[model samples]
Target chain A: MTPLISLLFALAGLASLALAMPRHAAQAKLGALWVARAPWLRGCGWAALGFSLLVRLARPDWRTGLIEWIGEAGLAAAIVVVVLMRRPQLLRGLPAVVLLMVPIAALLLR
Target chain B: MKTGFRQSMAWLHAWGGLIFGWLLFAMAATGTASVFKSEISDWMRPEVRMRTDPVDAVAAAIRYLSVAAPASSGWYMDAPDDRLAATIATYDVKDANGADEYRLAALDPVTGRPDAIRDTLGGEFFYRFHFELQLPYPWGRILASAAGMLMLVVLISGIATHRRIFADFFTMRPGKGKRSWLDAHNVLGVLALPFHLMISFTGVLTLITLTLPWAITANYGADTARAFADLDPGYYTRPRAGRPAPLGDLRAMLTDARARFGGDAIGRVTVENPNDAGAVLLVYRNDSNGVGYDGGVAAYDAVTGRLLSAYAEQRPAKSLYNLLYGLHMGRFAPSFSRWLYFLCGLALSATIATGLLLWTIGREKEGGLGNAFVARFTVGATGGLPLAMAGFFLANRILPVTLTGRQDAEVHVFFLVWGLATLFGLLRRPARAWIEIVALTACAWLALPLVSAVTVGLPYDIVGLGFDGVALALGGAFVAAIPPMLRKLRTVPKLRERRT
Candidate 1:
């Protein structure tokens, strides 16, 4: 579970880096490819990361839960940043999304 | 889109960077020094640097405290850790009229005896000054928060102004003039943007309530105490009971608390309602990962030492806050990560310095030293501050610990040295001032280890005293100072040549 969560986090980081790369022809093509396929890939990646975080949270040790939350938050923040950079207009409802997702995620995981 | 928003942002960035550049530079430099605070403290206090097994020594000290200060309400002991050598103990004593008094003593880890090495506060002074500047409560915090806000503005503006962030991401052409400095500053700032952003944001967030109290006042009603309690479950207050009770053994309670927290050592112990029946003991875990600034606190009944509650079992909101607080403090970071943080902190300081230099250069092109006062101020502040800091460390190493009013004298010497440096700068040429100040700083910093070794007879080796690491670090900083100092020196000659 930890490994899967780590992999998702790594993917999120890579995605952001790829998005942030220079807007040259090749880089733009790569970014566009990711943008085209990102919806499904990001959804799966977030889901896996969320699940692993939940698994870690359910453990008796509170430290493990806290560690998992950090991982989840980092992945979530990375995804939001990448998405916003790709499509700046997505920032309009970001605050509301954060407010909703954070409580909902906490409830579901807890 | 037609409003020239980018241009406005660039303007804001330039002005903001120019306005708070010096303060930000001081904060960054002090903050960088603070990252290695414990190590620096160890280097300064040579008497306590001797290696001794602390377990037995601490146990013996605890036994001694239990006897000597038995009538005292509560005793708190900070046992020697991996980074620190002296074990500090504080005792809360009740006077005849029922007034409370606190006494503190530092004990050698080896002999379990009082070690009155030096009265110098050591690196703690720099660490505190970085944020608080030793000013009274809210004022110091306000100043720090203002600096933090300026940093945020500078960062945002800097990013907006940079035409090509990635194109020059890895480009650094040293010794090229203002353009090179700008490139170096941009590269360092951009490469470590995430770290800088996170650190600054978290720093502001740490004091958000102070900065924006309306958020809590409006949301949580008038009970600020309750609001803070809700945010932090570890916080507890006990109603005083007039009757006194026999307090339990703190060492034993600490052992039990450590076991409960999954074998983590006790970092700090807090006793509430000391000398009363209602007194409760709270033991916190040390160096626990993910605990953030918040730690697991196990409350025990004062008399019987029965467990009341553990913070680890608190609500999710409170625990989450703790975790965030912990992450920002880097309490969980190992030795390697601490070094990384130190290096990043130094880079941040360099970034601020270079940013300030760029501003000065920009202004210089328009008017060459027209504002002599401003130039003198810059020379005094930039060069004199380092000399003052070096003097502080030197005083800590050389001053007699038992001298009457030595602590105050040491601090006075710091200010005096800094004052003299500034006066010298105003009287002399700015270029000459820079060279002289750098040379003095280099000499003072390089001589610190030798002073410590000679005075305390501690070997300068890494294994023996850990003083050499500090000496070498300080020496390296001095070495780095030479190129920049010489560059400033050469600037004067270049200007003269151009005029000729």
Candidate 2:
């Protein structure tokens, strides 16, 4: 159940990154290809963040909830960074990737 | 005013974070390490690992204490549970001068007799150092509070500077000059923003009395201690009248407490006014779902064997505070959560490292290394500290237990290694220095499991593959780092090639 929620959140973050991208090529070139896909990507990111929160609320387990919460926050922060650095935003996804990977890895390892 | 406000804040965030970043990183890393301090202690002590049930040892210690210190007042048993290796019992007695004296004994897990576990200082040292740095009084606490404030400022300014919060969501192009650094910082900051915020806020709150004494002074009328007492009802002020009194059996009390709480057995037992009329035994339940360092403390009347008060009965506000504290400390989490915290902590350290590296790279690109002694210090600190930590772990493994001053020697080695790393950073080229330190770090980390396997006959496989797993993971990371370090070392030639 926790993994499912985390996966959904990760997908959302990916979507948000896609949403955050600019439409035009000139701006896109300067920021890099990932930044260009920001428009949809931002949406996915926000959704992931929201879902992560929901999972935390639903799950009574503190450890899983905490990990999910951290993962969500990371996704949200990535979104915020993307919106702030309007021009080039491809690197904003690192936190989400790292955050999501931790819990997922823990689940696998455990 | 607006420009100045933004500029001042930016400056504050930058300089404050840069100055304290290394310290904060250390605190966080150590705190994270402390989440698994017991497990680490268990791995370090092989003698304790062999005994699955150290109950007999604990019973033996109780018997020993009962005989050795019969009239000495009360014995507080810090029994071994799932987490820790050794069970410690301390007897409270008064000296001829009428001062309290605590005689402590560590019981062997197998024999339950007084045994010396290797003087490695175990996990508690790192745990204590996280908040106090083992310094006297307010200094360590004050430093920690200052770092927390700095972290808060960084979080705020970092958010303000990154205007397009929603636009750049999940994007990572890796090598895009300044864009990459900004992305890296943003990603790390954003992903763990809540963690960063919660940790800092709770950290400040943990030391709230020190940070905001004005509130306590104003409300409680200059009686800060009273204010704390009000906040923490578990604190007892009145001492028991000195009289030899038979106390309730702690082992039985612990069993009752565990049954009541529906949790594991008691971890630590604290007896106040032992041998006094009003002697109270406070048995602390092992870590559970609830939050905070202070768990359910069940107080038993020494003579009556009746429950006086339980922490579970505390008011909502107090309970909420405990929960928040627990959450922040990761005390409530099971073993898995502890592991997760450990990994996240490492990532946080990596985040700081990457950020420092980006700052240096950014400045270097502008036109040679700038006169930012602060940035230089940060690089030295963030990079050098890890090397030092590895040295500490190595010293713990290598230093002979029988050697005089071995404990102090281990601590000194940590400082010496860190100091040397910093000196090397200052003396050598930054890129080259980083490569060298990283290589050293790798060697040190890789050596740990080998040392453990050689000294302790417990093969890496049977210890649930924990030590070897960590070593292999760290070693792989170091091996992967070789390419990057080599690439940075060859930067000048690459630039020349590009120009040609």
Candidate 3:
């Protein structure tokens, strides 16, 4: 359950980063909206990824946290890369879904 | 000498990656599978059901060994844990040549009797093949190390050459033939760059002594064993007493070890000279969950059941090495992390494979014997191996449980199937060979669940079902892939591509 949530967090983070890019953002449905929110989207991406690491670490201890962080980060990167290749338009909307998931995941985790 | 830095690096990357890509793919594929080795072993041997009372199984194994090989030099019991369903007891037995031969028995966790299951190599084959290549010991180790070094060089060179690597991170144009293959190669390599680098660098470190033994050789002269013993904190030996004596209760020692480790799982228990007055029991905590030089090894006077010393002291240098080695092995990873490792490994394998394909696709315009050979070889090796592994699984299910030399037969089937696939590749057209082999492999994979269901009934546990599930998914993927590939082949210019 934690892994799934953390993966969503990571996906959200990567999606924000992708949407912040001109090429992917230009292809997105809400290109102007993403462009207007580019800076915040980029920040949100990094913050989500960082929060993911924190959530992963919070599980038991630092050692396991570090390992899980690496694993979850890989999954996130893979998801981002695949999205970039196959469907750039999805990046704009993915962040919203990810943002929605984060609080729910945190609540469940708590 | 006049070539530019990027040009030189590109040359190095292309040649190095092409030369070692197949080996890297094989290692990555086998190593990925090896992540769930214990689970796969359990899935292979369906008879041994895991017991909740694993501690009781340790007691059971000790009892079995006491009567079985009391006079042996040592006894080691791999206690039944969450991953493993049976207690495995191995004891040193003197061979006819006066060399020590290890004998293994898989005992039922509850009854403590040997499980009457078909003997097979199980997951150990894949594990050993990853580093050893199923070759003679040092040669295989040396070859794997060399390949690791080449891979490290290739990775470094690849990054140095790809000036637009970051720019191309989001760039992928599929169905452009050579461009498509290159895009896939670049994307996979870039995305999993950290994983590839860590795995390669740590892989070389895992066999550092074999690759660069000069330091030890120079220090220890001809006695490298002495140096190893001095360096490794886990090394310990005590000579046997001439007088015979009955072994003490191991359950008491287990109780002491549990307390020592703060209730951490005990991975192994070793009883040295169990029937001698100098018998010593060594209990090692499973360090799969922690980064350490050695899991805590507690020594006990076997007859008296007295706790002597828990070997926890270690040099920082050795501890660092152990951490690197452990990270690469991923034996300590829980199921979720292990799946993550496996997934990354598959990506790495795909990265190498795409790189291999790109090499041939780039040379498609050249139209030469060498290019043709490379294409054919690529198809044979890449497509044939998975088919071979499927053959191994099929053999395991198909062969009679009690057939003589059944284990050896299963291994033979793997090689035979692989050989036949390679031959088929060599004889047929590259595109045709690939399609046939992949289709055949898919069929075999799809058959795995049904075969198991028919042969031994559906596996009751999740782990067993997981194997079947993965196989079916793989088969589905292959089936889904065929049409697009066939369509691509139809569109490509059909040059007279020779096999040789």
Candidate 4:
């Protein structure tokens, strides 16, 4: 459950980070909207990634968690790379969908 | 100054990468397979039948060892864990020349008999091949680490050469020939750069003593054993009392060891002088306990099950080394992390493959003999090797169970197929050869589970099923990759492509 949660966080983190770039934003067909939201998107992206790390490290073994966290983060970023190449137009809504997944995940965990 | 530095780094990255790319690709691919070695070993030994408690497995192993080599000096048993359903019993018995001859057999958890089991190296083959390249000692280690050092050099230079990592992190422009290859090399290198750095750096560190034994020589002069003893200080020895006595209870020793490790899993047990009065049982913690692999070692009196000496390395530098080594090995990783390690390893391999292809593609217009040689070899290294690995699996299922030197034969089949594939690559057009060989390998890999199911029954355990799953996944990936590859190749001039 935690892995899934953290992976979603990672997905959302990377998605927003990609969206923060005007080039990617324009490719997603939301240039003006992403241009206005760039700073917030960037902050959320870094913050989510950081939070995901913390969630991973919250396990009993920090070192194993840390390594797993790094690997999973890379995995999430790779998935984003694949998505960007395969269907660049989907980038407009992926971040929003993945971000909403976090709170829903929290509720499910509760 | 900056451009010059960048050019030098790029040159280093390209040339050095080519020199070691094949070896590194083999190592990385095999190492990824090695991550699930315990499961592979289990999958290979289908005759084992059942997954019982480790204690039950250990008892069966001990009985088998006692009957097989009662006069042996030592008995080493790798008891079954959750992943490996069978215990491996290895003993050292004296030969006619008074030299110790080591023998190993798998014990069935149900019957503890190895007579019905097939002789094979199982996953140990990949684990060893990665480090030894099947070469004899010292030479293999020296060459492997030399390759490893080159890998580290190339990886570092790759990072330096591609300084725009963030800017192009998500970019991969496929179907653009040289541009596509560079994009592949870049994105793969960037996303998993840290993993590649960690793996190669720690791989060098893992075999540092072999490559650079100056520290050991400086410390102990010529006695490396004494140096090892001093380094760990867990060394305990007792002279064998010539009086014959029964080997004591191992299950209790294991229970005690597990308790000592605070419920950590027990890895293996080594019993020295099992037939003598001064017998000793050493229980080591399983490598799966957390990240750093040292869960500590506890020595117990074989007769009385009394705990004697135990040690866990706590010295900062040694622990750091342990952490790095553990990370490199991934023995500490759970299922998810293990898959991550494997995925990252595959990326590392593909990064090398792309880098190799990029070089050949850049020089395609020249089309010299040297260019042709390098191009075909790259095809052989990237495409032929995986085909060879699938051949290893096919050979495992096809070879007669009773064949003498069957293990060596399986290895031979692997190399023979690899040799043939390389020859085929040399004969055919590079693009055609790549597609056909990869397609054939895909078929071979996809057929693995069916072959196993026919020879043995369908995989009964999760480990066996997992091996099958991965094999099918790899086959599917190969099949899926073909269309895109064909589409990409169609855009290029077929006549100008190298046919080495």
Candidate 5:
């Protein structure tokens, strides 16, 4: 399976996790409304991220798989940080709900 | 005498980062580009436009060597993969002085004919500059290693000093002068902390022997080469015999090695004593498939094409070292992973740049010649790098294709442009220098696509249109940055006048 979709899933997951944190979440007033649900959002975020890693690990070779996985994760983390800084609300519930489908689709493809 | 841990770390981070940050920025920027070294080389040499399986290319190279340097010691050929269309071959040949020297040739993989490619240092210059800074051996490497050590210290001290590392990862408040620069520095530093730490640590490890050879010297007592050979059997080099004989078909031997290794691709091939009685051929499997420096090496009698010895298994310790080395080099990375490395490298560069900017901004209120000098130097080095690189690409396109010593000329063009930028910085105000150099770099970037289209032909598969796309994108980014900068420049002067 291609790693692009998985990378997007990982980025979306990290964005959700970042937005759920009080510091980042408070940047957007909408984030404060869901601050109480941060724990649940974070858990879902980690699950999606773990699933994204699993997609990379499923490649034919372990060496490429491992390196690509870490690299993808790194890129995803940077993207999440940038997005949170610019528009934290994009990482809130609605977009997080939309992002959930990416990993689900990634899993089916795998 | 009773300084706190955070205070001590702050002192270390500030001073250490200031002293070595410029070199780190240069290394990061050039090293990021070096990740696409082969593609850049292909783009630089428009004459090399053929792509084929390396197996066929290897045959052509062997044939060329048999005729070109038949009486020489040996031959080595780096097989062309998808990225490169030409098989680069080197053979030992006697120069006009009758001294043994290596001659390199780029051959059309399909036709087995040598390509009259222009002499350009190509992307290898950037790769060399990344670590060696184009200085003399050992000294350049040693200086780079020292910078790496200083970088590691800065990173550790940065983490120690930053009390709210994770908490502040999301903080980036722009337009606060020194505060903004510090925010950017901290954010970029924290965002890619793992990547920064891994790269710096592995960079040190990659040259550990060179950095600290005392253990080897103490143990071996002046025979370090022999000691290394004993420790790592794979490092051994075979001596040529003083007898002449024709070499057997290398393709057939490679086929045998491939079959033995379950159809693995050959990464490198070395022909020892091409025309000698005691000749041998060494075939190494591509390391991309595994986290090892070399997958497996097999030795065959060059004349008879019979297997002599093979090293299919690696020691666990060596395997771990190879894996770390491979990670540091990223030679095993696929396209997407390579892009990720490039992006992380840019973040590292940005971190260094922002730290430099912060240093200047923090002292801007107490401005002096020293402050002004640092600011201008930072602007020159940071903005000048991209401009110089664009100038190098432009030089490659504009220079006479067949000019003698053209490769050295291209390097000279690079340094000359960079030196001019330094002078430009000294003469112009720091803000103006930043805007002007960036605008000039944008023009150079914008011209690349047009130049390539005129000279080489458009719709470049040279890096699968990557070179053109990146050129256009960089051009667009710089163009986008200029108008806002100009507006800022206009407003800043008025604000200063009002204050006066």
Candidate 6:
């Protein structure tokens, strides 16, 4: 439920969504194999987003938590977009690492 | 004015956005800075060292007020938090001419008496400038409200005018000139659209009372105070009984109020008719713990320590109003969320800047006075604001602490720098102005930590260090901007610039 962990999930989620798009997929050279897995990637992206929201909502003061989640999501998404623009190849590796790291970090931190 | 609906909306978006963008950019930038109001105030006032508990500070304030203004009409303290420990106590008293006036004191957190505090507006200047632009009376507020309304209009029209919203959601073409600027503007707008829309809506609504007072005027006639008082469900009033009685323990009332608030810390303490039999003590819970701003308030019998009435705003309309107001003011935001608000605010400012740049970028060959004005004005407003804000801080550090009208001197320096920077922008070529002012701003902001380090010796607290860190970060960002500006400045023909 920590903002940092939630932010990583959001970053993973948005990067997934961005990579699913053909234009971005081509820009990032995410590979034909990755592009072919668009639907799965999109689904995982949304699932990560939902989990991020759930993590934020898990706070005792969920009202404040929900608001912070939205703000952090925006911040996270912005970071992904800027990374995609500057170093598209960075997107190829980071999201997968984030996807693996987030849940483990969340559990350990908790 | 345009043939198509989208075109007409775009026309409105471009024109209206630029017109009010000057004030709106300033509003957003200052509002962003004011998010750390307490922290900034702490940075500005290195003199306040004690981090006293709210309960203890309230007790100290009551003790000092009891001895100093025994028969004062009322005593009020904006209870301090951990960030800024000093309490600002105001005592309502009858002046020699029989008119009501306030005795103000910046109570030392430890002693609860006025200290020889430096008379700078501190974060309050930015907070005030956000909505008021430091102008006289209702004028600045009204203008800000109007600009806020226009910002909402521009946001909506821009949304309407945009095509393929999702296709460009992640798009950013940084080196493609106009495409890049447009992409940035659009991304900054759409990424933080919820924030932008909510801020614009709530920002205007916050000042609606001042801008459009029809409802209050019609309902309460001339008694706006009564109208506002009636809006809050916990309001109370009791005439002073013509007998003297010592006030009860304010610290106990605070402890009681804390439990009453279900552990929310007290943010304000007010003692009405202190020393009278019917004296009442009111404690208000801090609004920072929640997004909703219905700060639970309780009125207590100042003589007997009995709870008189306790309530929070629960009326649907008022609750909604408080929620929206709280969102705009960001009083409830924690540090991370507050920084998000600040970044979103800066994005909005950048959107306006890029939008203004779009107008002049394509119209360089149009040879029109309007284009010329926007070209110059954009540089002044966008680049000049941060410079002027830095000057305000520099003045706070540099000014003679005991000089007469020290507060006014700080404020005057703020406005003076803003005006001078704008005038410089207007007089100089737009291209050169952008480079020079931005460079000046970078240096000014970079100078903040250095100035503070030399003057106050830079306290090692989070608030103090955080201010320095942020100032350094901003300075770094502006320093990064100067090379791009200098490179662009070389492209314009000196003769073509002279034609304007």
Candidate that would win on lDDT: 6
Q: What TM-score is obtained for chain B in each of the predicted models?
A: 0.86, 0.86, 0.92, 0.93, 0.92, 0.91
lDDT of 2 by residue, B1-500 (tens): 23766676666666666777778877877776787776666665556654534335455666676556656656777667666667766686677898877655556766666545665555666787888876787999988888888778887887776666655434444546567767676666666666777777877878877877887778999777788777866544356576667666656665666776765656666666655667776777765545555556677775567777776545777667776677677766666456656666665666666666666666765654453554466645767776777778777777886777565677788778878887777777666777787788888878777776677654543343775787768877877777756865677678879999
Arrange candidates, best TM-score first.
4, 3, 6, 5, 2, 1
Interface RMSD for each candidate model? 9.7, 6.1, 1.9, 0.8, 2.1, 1.0
Model 3 misplaced regions, further than 4 Å = A36-40, A57-60, A108-110, B50-52, B66-72, B92-101, B493-500
lDDT of 4 by residue, B1-500 (tens): 23688899989988998888888888888988898888877777777667787767777787787888888888888878877877887788888999997777778876778878888788888998999998988898788899989998998888889877888878777667678789988988889888999998999889987888899998899999888777676555687999998877878888888888888777787888887889988888788876777638899888887888998878888888888888899888888899999899999988988888899889988989999999988777678888899999888888999998787899999999988988898888898888898899889899999999999878876777888998999999899979977876785665546542
Clashing pairs in 4: none
Q: Which candidate wins on TM-score?
A: 4
How close to the true structure is residue A89 of candidate 1, measured as C-alpha lDDT?
42
As a whole number from 0 to 100, the lDDT of residue B419 in candidate 5 is 84
Query: What TM-score does structure 5 among the candidates reach?
Result: 0.91
lDDT of 5 at B85: 68
Candidate 3 is graded, for docking, as: medium
> How do the residues B1-500 of candidate 3 rate in per-residue lDDT, one tens digit apiece?
32999999988998998887778888888888898887877887888865756578888877877777766899888877778887777788777998887766677787777747667777877888899988898999899999999999999999998888866776677767777888778878887788889899999998998889899988999998798776754545578998998878878888888788788888888888888988888888876767543657788888889877777647778788878888898877877888888888888888988888888888877999998888888887878888888888889889998888787788899888878877778788887788898899899999999998999898778987899888999899889879878987776654435422
Compose the digit string of candidate 5's lDDT tens values, residues B267-345: 7788877788778888877766655675488889888888888776567876778778888888777787788788788
lDDT of 1 at B49: 63
TM-score of 1: 0.74
List the global CA lDDT of all models: 0.65, 0.65, 0.81, 0.84, 0.79, 0.85
Error of 4 at B17 (Å): 0.8
Which candidate order results from sorting by lDDT in descending order? 6, 4, 3, 5, 2, 1
Taking all chains together, the TM-score of candidate 3 against the true structure is: 0.92
Model 5 residue A68 CA deviation (Å) reads: 2.9
Task: Estimate how well candidate 1 is docked, as a DockQ score.
Answer: 0.04
Q: lDDT tens digits, residues A1-110, model 4?
A: 67778888888889889888877777677768667989999999999888888888898777777888888898999988888888888877887898788889889987
TM, every model: 0.74, 0.80, 0.92, 0.94, 0.91, 0.92
Candidate 4: residue B438 Cα off by (Å): 1.0
Tens-place lDDT per residue, model 6, B138-224, is: 888888889999999999999998986888998898767678888988888888888889899999999877877899999999998
Candidate 6 pairs with clashing backbones: none
* Chain B TM-score of candidate number 3: 0.92
